[model samples]
Every structure is written in C-alpha cells, then in structure tokens.
Target: MKRLRLAAPLAAAVVALLPGTAQADVTYPDPQPITGQEIIHDPTVIRLKNGGYVSYSTGGVIGARTSKDRVHWDDAGNAFAEPPEWWYEYNDTGDPWAPDISYRDGRYWLYYAVSSWGTNHSAIGVATSRTGLPGTWTDQGKVFTSETTDTWNAIDPAVIRADGRLWMAFGSYWTGIRMVELNPRTGKAAEDATVHHLATRPDAPYAVEGPEIVKHGRYYYLFASYDACCSGVNSTYKIKVGRSTDIEGPYVDSTGKPLLEGGGDLVLEGHGRYIGTGGQSVFEDRGKDWLAYHYYDAEDDGTPKLGLNRLHWTKTGWPEVF
Candidate 1:
C-alpha cells in the first residue's frame, strides 16, 4: 500500500503524536528527509502525469521546484521567463505569490495571486501549460480580484471539483476564507458567481487564509493556515481544519463549532525544531494523502523548508498529521 511506505519513518521516530490529539508535539513530517532548495513559502504541489512531483510557490515569478520521488528536490526555475505585463498593475515588482496547480482536461492550469503587502487590492491570475512544467505555461489572465473597498481579499487559491462543478477557495486576513464557482470551460469565475464565506478568525485582521479542500467519504474538508507567517521563528503560524458535507459550506470543527466563528481543530503547529508550520496545501499520491506546507527550521537559522507528512484520519473523521 502507498501508506505503508511511510510506516518506516514513523517507526524510526519511535513515537506517535498527532495534531489536535496531543498537547505536546515533538515529532512531525520531516522524515522524507527532503533535500535541495528547501527554502519555499506558500507551496502548492502536484504529481505530474509522468509521475514526477512539481511545486509552485510564492517568489520570483512564481518560483518552482521539482522532485522525481517527492524527496530529493531540485530548483526547476521560475514558471514564467518574465512576469506578464498585467501583473504590474497589482504590484510594482510584477511578483506573483502562492500558486495553485491542477491538471484538468488534457492540460494543466495554474492560478496565482498578485498583490502588494498590507493591502487588500489583489488579484488572482490563471495560466495554462501543456506539460505541467515550469516555463511551459502561458499566461491566461485573471480569475478573480478583490478591491480595497471590498471585505474579502483574493489570494492563495486552491481549487476543487465537486458534483461536476469547479470551485475556488481563496482569501486572506481581511475577512478570512471565501469561495466562488468557476466556469470549468475557461477556468474563470462563473458568470454572476456568488462569493461565499467559508472560515474566519472572528476578529479584526481575521488571520486565516490558505485554504485547500479535499473530499473524503461523506464530507469535504477545509484545511487552512492560521495566525501570522513570514516572521521566521517568530511566526505564530499553525495549520487547522474543519469539515462540511456540502461543497458550499458552513464548516465546523470536531466540536461542532462553525469555522466562520473562529473554530478549527489543530492539524499542525510549531513543535521542536519545526517552527511556524503554515502556507499549506494537500495532494494525493499513490492512493494516499500528503499534507504539504513550509516550516521554519530552528536549527537552520529559521530558513523555511518544505513540510511533507502522510495524512491520517481518526475513527471519528478528524485529521491527524503524522
């Protein structure tokens, strides 16, 4: 079984500790023993048709990294040779951040965010690629946007298809997480698509974002990053989750408290040398689920390293990160 491949690492660690199940966590995902170009932020990873893994992230024209076995990573260069001219309208640097990659139809579609720091004036853009490799993508333009006057900020997109319809989940500190339906034909928001709120921190600056949805059994689960990020060791970032039966959700944690009310069961948090575990996305490989995020390595002077863990579920249906 694909899950069995991770058992060796769990045995080597000599103990089992799961997020939200334990008060003190000393072990986590690092046993993949990831190597090469480990510094990354806001990563969205995907397994290619040819069976290699590629991840697109924030920085340098949508920075990229690829691994043949999901362990030994190599810097694969930026997704675009140059930023599309449209990007400069959102930021002077034409920098894009937090890309989500998915394979649809016979091609790959990439969605990313362009925005300035400390502002809600942001836009999420789309690009398409034939090979799902860096540099093969052609810019396709904006999928969604948020204005300063609006309550939700558009960034950090994660897409999921449910019941034959495509949907995008996105948002940042302004009002937390929100969702919109996408036109599967063009990868854009559906005509007159209504924006829906998913989760929020319930306070000013809400502090929740980076949402990814995965369907399992009878429900759709929402996984998200909470708290401050990008501060290295000082970062208070953590990963949390809630689940709902409907694709458009009023998600709730195990306690039955709604996510819109600042409730989520803990999934991963800073433990031992792994600090600030956030900027997350999840992907399925070999019939198993893997949670992917970036963490600040205390031993490495707080350099961000990729966080990969085999995802498990409790008998009650809650997520447990190993």
Candidate 2:
C-alpha cells in the first residue's frame, strides 16, 4: 500500500511495449488462478529450500502464508510473534508493511517498513532467517530511517545485490523512489551512503513507490507502483518500469525519458477484475522470471488478493506480463 492521495490519474499515459503475447490493444490479463490464503498486500514471496513457497505481506506482524505447488496455499502465521521494541519509535502500533525477502550469503534477508499513515517519519528494518519461514525470523534491527525533515520516506524497501554490494531502493509519495547502499556484512545503510533519486512525478506528492530492481541482460530495470493504493476498487495503483545501463541511474522509460522527470513505461495496469495491480516484486525460479503483486479483485468487491504472472522479456530486455 502507499501513502498520501495521488495528485492526478497516471498518464493513460504510456502503453506497454509488448510484442507477441500481450501485443497490441493494451490487453491486461487476469491473474493466474490461485486459491486459499490468497488475500494479501505488498507481498514478498520466496521459493523455500524445501521446494515449497512462502509469502509475507503487510498485516498483523507481517502476515505469512505457504504453498506447495504455487497454486494452493495455507495460512502459516506471522513472521514475528511480537514487534521489536524499536519499532514503536516510528509508529505507535509498531505495525510493519511492504516486506522484501531475498536469499544472500547463504541466508535469507528480510526488509520491511514501520510507520504511521501519511507521515514520512519512517524506518526500514531488517531480519534474517535461515529457513525463511514464518515464526523463524531473527530480528537483526533497523537498517535505515527517515523523519519529517527528510525529503524521502523510508518505506516499501526492495533490495538488490550487485558486485558484492547490497543496495536498497525505497521511498513513497514524498519524493518517489530512492536508493542507498547497504553494508554487506550488516545489511544496514552504509555509514555515509548517499540516497540517490530514481523516479518521481514531476509535481508534489509524487505518487511513485514500491521499488523493485532486476538486472536483465545489460540493463537494470526499475519497477515501481504509480498512483494511489489501498483504496479498494477505486484504487488507481498501477505498475511502471524504467531502465538504466548503470545501477545508480539515470533510469528512463523506453522512449529514453529520464525517470527523475516522471518518465516510465506503463507495464501493468488495471483491467477487468484485476484492478490496482501493484506492490510488486520479481523473482526468478527454475531459470524463469516471475512477477508477484497484489490486485483489487473487482469480482470480489475489491478484496486484495495475491497475483502471480510469468514475466517475459522482449528481445531488447524490457519485461512483459500477460
């Protein structure tokens, strides 16, 4: 989910650059049929070492669920049995949201946000788990933070590893997406790391957040949620993308417009029952890439549900979802 109401509807703005499957006509495909424990928001899913799958999302203590074949799921439990003491510093309830899970250095790293609604006083924290399962995480502590004085909000954290360096991309309506380097050993912000701006709307209260970076071919693709979220059926949340040859970018849409100037290629948008398709992450399994996100189900009266789609790449390296 995102903070602050959006200033305007996202540009109808740009069309996806798909060629074959999602080619022509702007057809937004429905999510793959999934059942059981499907309601979730801002989901971060990992294929466990046991060959099963576990997903953690925003809710009570970072709500969790599991699956055996990636179709049927079961409620597992919360990732944390209790909130860490420091979490209260950011928010009264110590509620955490928009978690990112990844495997690095032979262990799993979990990053999540703690903050109250509509405020930039936020913190992104880290926890580790050997098995990456619910109730098995060890709270490592806070990694980064932001306050009312900070231009960027430190929420919706997504991390990507490159060249032995850990980089976290985070932000919200305050100033769009931002990236900072993390200490490899500690998984915390580097002592003097500079926060680099990645994407934003040209105006104030820019509605871009939930940054996910994936290295494909020679470029790094930045995926982010644009417009409003958490409003049920009325939500205008959509997914957009930009790319850069360098990790610390200068990312731009297909037309070569810089993301810093509000440029991004429309990737996924609301269509049919799948409305507000955003809060996404990308993970590769069995040599193929997959996109995981949440959508407001129109048929279900705008209930948020898990959405999974196999990602296809164009010959030029941009991503496509059908």
Candidate 3:
C-alpha cells in the first residue's frame, strides 16, 4: 500500500483556489493515491476508444491493467497468456519490458523488448491487435536488435509517427538513445533505414533509458529517465526532457544546452515516500494530457507501482506535470 500520501482535504482546497494555467515554475504534485493491482514497472498507457484506460508494463508476458476512472485500476491480465515462441531465443526469462502502445489505422501496435541485463544482445519486437485487450495480440516478430559488438543496447522500444513516417527510439546505458525509421505498412524496421543517434550522457555512469517522444506544437520533445534504477528505494531515477524543432533532434534543455552534451530539464523527481520516479509515457486522454509511469514506494519497502499525473504545457512550450 505504498501509495502517495497527499492531504486529501488540503489538496482539494488547493485545487479549488487555483487559477487556470498554473505558473510555469509550479512544482509537480505527488501522484493521486491509487489502489489495487499496483505493481508495475516501465508503464505505458493508452485511452481506449470506448473511454476506459488501459496500461501495459514490463512483466512476465507483459503486464496489463485497466481503469474505468483513471484513478482506480484493476489487473486485467497479461498481454500474452503465454510468452511468444520467439522470446526464449533472446532471453530465457520470457518477459518483456517497456512496452510502447499506439493506435494507427484502426489497429493497436505494441512494441516491447526481450533481453538480459548488462548486455547489448537484445531485440525489439512488435505485436498488433484489433482490440487492445489481453491475449488478443498477434506477434509481429522482431523490429530490430543489437549484438555485443554494437555500442547500443536495443531495448526500451518507443514509437511515434513523425513527419508522416513511423519512427522508433530505443537504447539504454551504452551509447545512449538511438532512433530508426520503421516500415509504415508493417510497423517493423524499414529496409535500408539508417539509425540516428539521439541523446546521451557523456559523464560517468552515463545512465539514461526509458525514452518516450511526443510532438507538441512545433517541437518534438524527448523525455528520458536519468541515473540508476531497479535499486528499490536506493534508486536515483528521475525524469528529464529536451526539445527540438525537428523529430531527429539536436534536442536542448530549458537552458539551451544540448542533450547530446548531457543537458536535460528536470520534469519529476522523488520526494518523501515516493522514490525513483521514472519510466514514463505521455498521452492525451479525456481532453487533458497525462503522464503515466512507475515510482518506487518508499513506504512499501521500495515496491514499484503505477503513477499518473496530468500534464500541462508552459507558456514557452515546455511540458510540465503538476
């Protein structure tokens, strides 16, 4: 039960007094306390066409949860009743991480990864479903992969349609984040596509992963997690972002420092009982933009759980969650 502890009455009163469009320097509030089926990591959410919200996460067979009101979630099932037959060939664990869910052309596309830790030997795969419900997906096979010789780890798959073409951004703790073009028709890596290097931390530890990209207004914003993760309450994970006028970025932070040189604007960080707030996904739902991610609950001895917060755009075009 390591949920966020906000004074409900005080929070309500604060909201009641707030004016439209909070100040650009406003601090992000803690996530609303949610109950039931909370264990999740690397979560990505989608608003169903019928209005119910569903989230997919990293877990055995890809974790799935649903919510009717976006505040109370219930475990639905795993996206796969059984791991896809090819998963074992990449990693014997039969688990997938950091699923990116998107809908296009009347179908739902889910991209995920299978790999062991501390290695570049990994693969990104895709599945499509007419209905995004659990067990309905048809495995679309490998979109891309990397070997030990490569400088990048091919995991943490995130897809977006930019400039009328499907593109994917992925990588972790090696050469930083990288991007590639996808076959618009198949949602797989496009033939003859070139990989484009995106952001990286040139400093020690160089820990960056869980990239989610969104195009807002005239800029493409790259959101990524920084620092160490998976260490329970000791994890130092936090979310950071940068923006570029073009999808293929020379992304820069609020100070105008380039992300290629380790610059990023802080978005959210742990405070009080919430720790390691990272692994995020952004989407527009019910007329409001939302950020969905997982945070380690310090009160629960560092168990990870799903967290959601409304996102707002600043006057200068930066995105903030409060």
Q: Taking the tens digit of each residue's C-alpha lDDT, what string does model 3 give over 1-322?
A: 0111112232321223246754333234788678888999999999888788889999869989998888889998899989888888788778788899999999999999999878788999999998887889999899999889988888999999998998999989886889999998999886567989888998755688989899889999999998888999998998899999999998888878888899898888787777999989998886788888888999999999988877777777887665
What range of 10 consecutive residues in model 2 has the weakest lDDT sum? 1-10
| Model 1, span 79-116: residue lDDT tens | 99999999999999999989999998999999999999
lDDT of 3 at 246: 90
Task: Give lDDT tens digits, candidate 2, residues 28-73.
Answer: 5567788888899999988988898999999999999999988998
**Candidate 2, overall lDDT?**
0.87
Where model 2 places Cα greater than 4 Å from the true spot, the runs are 1-24
In model 2, state the lDDT of residue 14. 30
TM-scores of the models, in the given order? 0.92, 0.92, 0.91
Model 1, runs deviating above 4 Å:
1-31
Give every collision pair in model 1: none
